[model samples]
Target: MAGVNDQRDDRALRADCGSCFGLCCVALPFSASADFAIDKDAGKPCSNLQTDFRCGIHTRLRQSGFPGCTVYDCFGAGQKVSQVTFGGTDWRQAPETASQMFAVFPVVRRLHELLRYLTEALTLHPARALHGELRRLLEETERLTGLGPDALEKLDVATHRQDVNVLLLRTSELVRAEASGTMKDGRKKDRKKDRRGADLVGARLRGADLRGADLRGAYLIAADLTGADLRLADLIGADLRDANLAGADLTGSIFLTQPQLNAAKGDLSTRVPPGLTRPAHWS
Candidate 1:
């Protein structure tokens, strides 16, 4: 029952750029690096942002040296802050509202991210024992997203995120424990997968049975994970930049974020969890 509700919520949590006022372009800062061409400070609109609140080089963001922009997803928080919290008033039109709006954007973005994880957790049948708690946290997180600008600006997002992470960690444990039990008999002996913080850059791991693996904080830059079975794997903070994900199955992957997928290379055959869109660059 809660699973059904989660699927519905998932759609709303996706980024609707057309409905947004380009808050990401103005509210977030980026340092000059391989991912971005130029330095931008918080609250200052990106030089590429046009009068219509759209990226001037949206079609050629990567070519324009703004690859970082391609991976950013606000989880629909931009539009919610623009239309709902501020009542459809844009920061440009009302300059006085700019600071508060900027402050609230990140807070709501974090809440929406937590909601995304909670929604995904609810879908894990193996974690059914924790579904009730996941649903409750999802509801609470959703409520936080609906708070007004003043309340949102005052929110302690870090503390709330810590609280939510506890539930997510528990959910991951339950789901992965089940996955471990189902591993092939021969591989069971070698299933003590704890690769946290491993430097796996450009590693050839095609078709690897990485189910229930702890890949948290692993540096997988340009790694080949083609046809990999990543079910129940914890990908929190894993650097997937330029990684190949063609034919990889990440359906039940835990803590995998849209930005992480966007940073990697994948194809139509790559299977992702619900609510995540395949990267446009993927074949």
Candidate 2:
């Protein structure tokens, strides 16, 4: 739960894939599974990715059982690089630039990820005092991302992540500083003590009880009934990538997906997993 001020700045982040050069799908590898139809090497395109730089199976990704692709979000790094850094040049038109673009893709991705987290942290009132520091770090990171290919290639992302992580911890402390003494509500929350191996698939749980519930290894695929309760739920290894959660209560569902949460619905009070975006319809 955010203080009064945090709720006021509840703008959600979104991935503009068009602005990106299909980096994550191309630059990263994925195992063939229900989410991905086939194996792909790092810096290789998925078969479903199109020449126009859009997912060919976008509409049917979930229907075709490639739910993972539907849930993936690049945190707006795609457009930031494609439009901002490369000036809308794609790999197909200039194949010679693929190597540099690939190298810079992950680099800009890290920076964009930092932007997502810092932007979210800035929403909390207790963390408001860190706004200046956050802004400074954000600007520095943004500036570094805009450097030339050679300069960006030589940048040490690992060291930068370590420094940024420190700021993230401070931001977490600020968000949770005020709610130190509140008791966990039981009725509208998941029981985290023991709910291991539960089969909650397609369950009608809109606004249902689930505070502090242990939902490790649970199968929650295709579940309906949005706006359900999920406060303080221990969701380690839980499969919720494609579950519908529009307006659902998820204040503290630990280890959940940003893509899962992004596809669902929630607001500022809906505590989501780190490095993820809020759903589009969240209020």
Query: Of the candidates shown, which would achieve the greatest TM-score relative to the real structure?
Result: 1
Number of clashes found in candidate 2 = 18
Show where candidate 2 strays beyond 4 Å.
Answer: 1-13, 182-248, 251-257, 260-283
Full-model lDDT, candidate 1 = 0.86
CA RMSD per model (angstroms): 2.6, 6.5
The backbone clash count of each candidate, in order, is 0, 18
Instruction: Report the number of the highest-lDDT candidate.
Output: 1
Q: Can you give the TM-score per candidate against the true fold?
A: 0.89, 0.68
Q: Give the TM-score of candidate 2.
A: 0.68
lDDT of 1 by residue, 186-229 (tens): 44624688888999999999998888788978999999999998
